[model samples]
Target: VVDFAKFKNLIGAGFINAQRGLDDSTHAEKDILGKILGKLFRSGNTDAAPSEMKESTLALKQVVDGMQKTVDTDFRTGVAKLLPGLKIFGYPGISDSELSTETTLNVGTILESHTRIRYDQGDGLFLPETYNGLGSRNLIYMLFQLYEFFRDWQSRLIENGIYLIFIEEPEAHLHPQMQQVFIKRINEIVDQFSTTLNVGKPWPVQFVITTHSTHIANETEFESIRYFLTEKNQQRTTRIKDLRKEFRASDLEIDKQFLHKYLTLTKCDLFFCDKAVLIEGPTERILMPNLIEKVDKNLTEELKLKGQFISVVEVGGAYMHHFYKFLDFLELRTLVITDLDSTALESGKYPACEVSKGTHT
Candidate 1:
């Protein structure tokens, strides 16, 4: 049921629950709340005896029940609510037919609610194999799978407990438009869950993601970003948030609008790149990634598996100074592969990396 090709991914979940019988075989002392919350979500029964259930399980069951009743009452009205300024489509003879065939996701069964996306074939009914099939659209399939994973993660969020979600390479199969809007949609959903129960206070939910999409990283706030590197067979993370001693105060004053705009214009991959090879043109950008893969398959395979791949950025020779000036705390190994096209070694046109005698950068 990890796949979400169809809205109902639970076709086999009940079978798995029956096979495992996770609760039946365990004792109260064995599956404590600490242990249960620490693990992935397992099926629970609300009808079970009090001694047999954990406090976290009961809370989720109650939350799901309350949300279910609110949605059910809207179904009795027999008409869907239309967004303002949007009118329902009307055909010549089908004006009386309902705007769209109704299909509701089963959040009432302790599942998450989903908005059904449908396309009209010949008949008006929202039939199978309409538009949900991934044969034509690959982006929808990839995002659908990510949502399935997130839905499962949400069940593990015990009330008043810290929860985290991890994702890697969310840009898979996504177009530029989808990539730009991805993090915004996720933030909206997280904000909703936090404020659902208490009006003023929200739940604490955080997540980490590894990606190569500058579009996704550009959408992210500066505070949420962290750089990662592997040095001498040991992995390290760079938290730019508290690196005041190592970085200059001026480095922290980067303009948010300029950052997003410059990255978008230059198509800079610095936002999510693990290691960077800064070049001077499109010729290197198109050829360097494949060239690196061919040079060392082992490094390439590791990067692919861990989602920490290197990025080749094409920064024009003139603008490199501005880039180096702003991102002073770039911890990733950067190789400034610029051309020594100038006769004067002392000319100021090139990037600052050249004038610094290659000591760092």
Candidate 2:
């Protein structure tokens, strides 16, 4: 009679082969053999067809001949090599079912090897979307790598006694708070490294950055500020005229409180004055009034010139526009002649209406 038990053992072995990327579909064929034996081989058949008889004769001969061999030296040793974790039963010892259990352990080994290789290759790296793979990574690693490269470059610059550093778009791709941290991170890293190295001098890296970020702009002082204004015709432009030491102690004190903190009030004054004509500003005030008197020859004379009382305000161009409408409200004859600023005219909202077809100045 055919052995159904031996057929089931082969099927379990085939499964392990497939999982290990080994050749063969022996398991499926063995299962088919088991089903066939269960249905057709209930009774022992002494007489059979020529082909069937021959196959059974050969198989039976092999079994009887194999039984004559020493179980310990031949079959047991060979099986132990093939299936390491094979467990044995009682007197019958090591049935085909027990061999199948041993093969199950081999299948686990195959699966583990494949899984480890996949993990090492970073299976999720090329995936289009995110994955929860244990070996996956994020952009922080790339950022840290880039930071190391730049820190080395900055150190070289410091070694040569380089003082100036300019960076544009330092806030690129970052939120406001992140931009602040970005600056802080650079500052902290450079200072810390430089301190440890004792490079050239203290705080070796000084920076000048151009940024449209309001947070960055707010962090600057007046000396670091530079303002430029262009007017309607685009021909007029001006920059702050320095008069740092020209003013008296009182004027400088006034400017200290006014220039930076009260820029709004100063800008408005420019709009109200008929000719802003920035004189020697804070320090310039000491000699500006006298200079105007000298030029106009009005040492002792007073004339009712309409809008001629030019308020020579001593302030920067930024806050100049602050007082434009305030003076206009007071019905003062004002002209902001300090800079060729078109901020008022650019909006096309000045008080002057477009002249009619027949009108001419």
lDDT tens digits by residue: candidate 2, 197-299: 3343453445655565544443344445433333336667544322223223463555444543544333333322345454324656676656666666643
lDDT of 1 by residue, 20-123 (tens): 11222332222221222322224233232122234655566567567556656765344455422123454465555444334443323223222234456666
User: For every model in order, what is the number of clashing pairs?
Assistant: 0, 10
Candidate 2: lDDT over CA atoms? 0.40
Q: Point to the candidate with the largest lDDT.
A: 1
lDDT of model 1 at position 61: 59
Query: Could you tell me the TM-score of candidate 1?
Result: 0.43
Please, what is the TM-score per model? 0.43, 0.28
Q: Count steric clashes of candidate 2.
A: 10
